[model samples]
Every structure is written in C-alpha cells, then in structure tokens.
Target: MRGTALGAGVLFAGGLGGGWALYTKLSDNITADDAAAAELARYERERPTALVRGAQNILVIGSDTRAGDGNRRYGKDSGTERSDTTILLHLAADRRSATAVSLPRDLMVHVPGCLQSDGHRGEPSFTLFNSAFEVGGSACTVRTVEKLTDIRVDHYVVVDFSGFKDMIDAIDGVQVCLKKPIDDKAAKLRLPAGRVTLDGEQALGYVRARKSLGDGSDTGRMDRQQRFLGALVSKVQSSDVLLNPAKLYPLLDAATSALTTDPELASLRGLYQLVRGVRAIPTEHVQFLTVPREPYVYDSNRDQLVAGRADALFSLLRADRPVTVTKKNTSPGDSASPAFHGNTAAEDSCT
Candidate 1:
C-alpha cells in the first residue's frame, strides 16, 4: 500500500507514471527516449531467462553516491559508490503478493568478474557484497546476486540520496515512530522519542542514523528504514496522490530523475506495465524480510549467510512460493534471529 511509488520505485508509483510508455520508441541512436528504449531492447537480447509464469524479480539498489545536487554535501565521490541499500523485490506471478528481501551490505560473498562502467572488466573475488556495486555498478551486483541465489533478476533500479530526498519532500513528509531521543551528529539527525512526521532531509538522516539509534547496529537501523518505508507506502496509497496529477507529477519526476535502470525497465512503457502488474496486489499481501545470516566465523565484523536457512529462503523465491517467516526462536543467544519478526505492508505505523 505504502510503496506503490517509491519502495525502490516498484511499490508506490504503480498508478502515477503509466503514461510514460506512450512517449517514445527504441532506436539505434541513444536519444533521451531512444537511449532508454535501446537499453531495454539490449537487456532483452542478453538476459539468460524468460519471464517465469509472470513473476518478476527486481533488484532495487539505493546508492549512497555524493555525485548530485544536495548529495555532494554528504561527501565527495571517491570514484565509485557502494550500495547503501539493496532489495531483491519479488512480485508474485498472479500479482497477488510481493516480497522484498533486504541483502546486508556487510555480508561476505563472491563478487564475480564484471565489465565496469569505464569499459574495463574486473575479476571475481571474495569480498563484501557491496563491493560488487563499487566494481561494476548494478550489473556486477546483479550478476553476483544471481550467482548467489540462483534466481534470475528481471530488472533493476538504482536511486541516489538526492532522489530519495526529493521524493519525500514532494509527498510532504513521512510519519515515523521513535522510542527514545536520538542525536547523531554524523548523520545530521536530531530527534526526541515520539511519533513524528519527517521531511526530506530529516527522513534521510533518520534512515541513515546508526550510531545514535537502537543498539548502534545495522539491523536496528534497517528495521527503522523498513518501518519508515511502510509508513511512506501508507501515506501514498491512502491519499489521492496518484489520482491528483498536480501532486503526482512532482513525485513521478523526482522518482524517475533519480533512477538508473536495466534496459527493459528504463522506459516509461516498461515501467508502466510493471506498475500495472504491481497494483493488482493488495498491501496486506506484500511482505518484507532480511536474508538470514550470521557473523562470519573468521571475522565477527563481517557476515556470512546461514547455509541451510539462506538456501531455503532463496529456493522459495526461485520457485515463486510463499516464504514462511515464523515468530519463533530457532536459535539461542542470537538477537538477529528474533522470536517474533517480519513486517507486511498493512502494519500500523505506530507499532
């Protein structure tokens, strides 16, 4: 319900940008519309898999790049940017349900060799999962994920800091809950414990603030980000944002402006079709969960996917089956594996 436009661009913009596909056609030369259409056509040619019974796997990468306006304030672009956030979004074949699996950046994984943006290719190696993004942008990241999960990714969308901030401001603000006071200088966030509505800048800081938030852990920060996203979805779907062209236009422009996508997903037509399918699912059917993982045995700072559990989760997605997330503790002394967990689109923001 809340993400139809911006939940990695597949969730919230379901009804708003449907008109984009009518504007252009694919051609050999790369014009604004031409470039996008050609890109999508190229992807169609190179991808190894066909559509799976109507199911779609979209990789949404939230890049923490300081290359654009309002973003450079964060820091200078030191050449390449790491994926600040990554979600493997799975839309069910029937368009009746959607599941977004968050992949932790700190996880240790095999980064396959890939062609870089600069026309050079890098070799595969064992490194942080986010390193794939740094080495070859989204393609490399997608390759690594496919190799790791054995599930084909149909499309991808990369959004930078400025875009995320602009979208929030376009929508007014998003509501969030804070259990205690927080003042993180590094993230530029300062807030008191309570329910509050956050504007663009504050929302970014809220999601990015780690040192001053719960347990000072990435997992805790991710939970907050998930809840904030849930609230944003609620705001968009419940309001007349999609129906009101005046309000929808800015939101659409902000979202589209911030995205770098796969060829097929690069055009308005491709995205319109995607949104149409996603809109068929009710918010209650959409679910969110993190990939099951634990600290690497050799290094507590880095993470390694829990072999059996991780494979089971990936397999369910590969088969387009419903993922069962129980609220029961299956491990001892592991806060990461909570006894009660997981969130769906229908969750109350206050909870």
Candidate 2:
C-alpha cells in the first residue's frame, strides 16, 4: 500500500513537470516588438493620451510580408511589407462590450513622416493608408492611426499570413454560408454556393479575394471580413476550445507562434489578462463595423473618410462610449443620433 501511494505521487510530480515545460514553450513563441516600443517612446510627448482609465485600444495588423518561409508562396519576396488588414479594436472600460472598426487599406490619409528602413526619416505625405506600413512597419502604422483617430493605441499585434492560416486550422476551420459561388484564381480560392466550412487556406483566400467578390471594391471586402471575424469570435467562444485543456493547447501554440506584439502583451500572462475580459463579454455585445468612408473625389479607386460621420464615430470610441450599430443605414443629416451600418456577433447567421 505504501509503495502504491509513493508511485502515484511520483507520477503526479512528473505530470506537473511536463505541463510546466509545455507552458514555457508556448509562452516563448511570442516575438516581442521591443524595437517598435522604443520607436514609439521617442515620440511619447506627441502621442495621444489615454482617455479612459481601464479601456484598451489595440491595433491588430495583418502583415503582407512575403519574406518569411511559409509566406513566400503567396508572392515573391517584395523586400517590403504592407498592412493588408488593420482593425482598431476597442475594449470598454467596464469590459462589457467590444468593438472592432476596420480601416480600409485604400483609404487616403495623411501618412506622417516615419523612420524608414534606410535610417532616414521620410517626409510626411498624404497617401494610401497601407503605405504607412510599407514605409515603416508596425510603429509607423500605429503612429498614423493615432494621428488620424486621436485614439491612444494601448498595444499592437502584427499577424502574418502563415500565422493567420495556422490559427484558423487550430480552431478546426470556421463555418460560413455563401450566397453565391466564387472562383478567384488570383486569390487561389474556389468554392461553391451555400454553407461550407473553410480550412485555413480557403479562409485566407476568402477574406483577401477582392475582384471576384461583391462589386470589386475594398469597401465591400471590408464588410465581408468583418462578418467573417464576427463568426470566428462566436466560434471560439461557443466551442470547447477554451474549456477543454486538450483543445486549448493547440490554439495557444498556434496563436503565440504567429504573433508579434507590444511588450505589454508579449507573454502568456499578459495575453491571458486581455483574453479574460474578452471571453466574458457576451457575444451579442461584440460589434464589427467599418469607419465611415467613400470613394476619393480625385481618384475613384481610392477611399476618403466621410466628413462628420467618421469623426462622430471616433469621438464615441475616444470617450469609451457605446457605439450603436445596425444593418439599416442611418440618416446622414442626423449625426446627433449616430447608428452606423454594421452587424453584431449575434446578428451573424446563414439565414
């Protein structure tokens, strides 16, 4: 009997040791963006102040960097990268609501002078929004966003193509209902109409496919991306991925392996603190919308923010106030009662 008890104790200790090793491995997968933090600190006095005490604003950037191993298949090594997708994610101070506002890559904005790779400061110019990333990477993109919205970015996360695909696969694919068939050779995606579950590769192609979907406008593409993300959030929250340790480990490994984040969110503990608030928020409170924008007057291909409309939305976010959204379009004249065209996680459905 004494031998049996001793053996059980030894086995338990071994199990705990193995768990710690796995934890360390997963935590170490995150790449800390210390250089970006140092760059931002250089202009600390000029950056926006935190408006709300506990509210957090994280800039999530999808990097189109083709230099990495798994990324080269997308295209030739361009020697530079761009912010393929940028979303300013706002978490309410009370931690009851969350909003994700997608910024159009083609939106024309003032790209502030940022430090370039050549070690020379590039002159500030009004150009496409994504150019900020191509010029200076994550630091420049965060600075540009702060200047444009006057919202303090608490942190930033840059996820590459391979990481995005791996994360989707870790979740075992996400389900979406298509209204029509799609075949885009450029995006390397071909899918039939109706309900379907997309693997990582197919999911990437679906979100990035512009020409073959909608009216071939970036605006329409943004809307589609928002819906897909909402679906993803719902999937993660509703599934056993979070509750079951077996299913959760793969997700953490995949997510951490693909992330390059600010120093504040570089560890497992920091990410857990952030995710704690996110997971508790009811899915119905999770909202997704694009900033108010229209085609540029000079160039129809480019986009420009709609006057009054965009500022009003930004003001609500800056003050950490609730942002109301709906599928119905609101009156352009009534900025006082602003309800932007958007959908909530609860509203996303195949029907």
**Most accurate candidate by lDDT:** 2
lDDT per residue as tens, model 2, 17-40: 586666567668889999889889
Give a tens-digit lDDT track for model 1, residues 1-351: 323543324333343465333133211111132332343344444444534678889888889888878888888879779999898999889888888888888999998777666777688799999998888777778877877888888777888898888888888887777777777788788887788889999999888777677787778777777777777766777546765656665676676677777666665556767767666576677777788889989999888998877877777788887775442243322343322245676776455
Alpha-carbon deviation at 126 in model 1, angstroms = 0.6
List RMSD in Å for every model shown: 5.3, 6.5
What does the lDDT read for residue 163 in candidate 2? Answer: 90
Worst 10 residues of 1 by lDDT: 22-31
Off by over 4 Å in 1: 1-51, 326-340
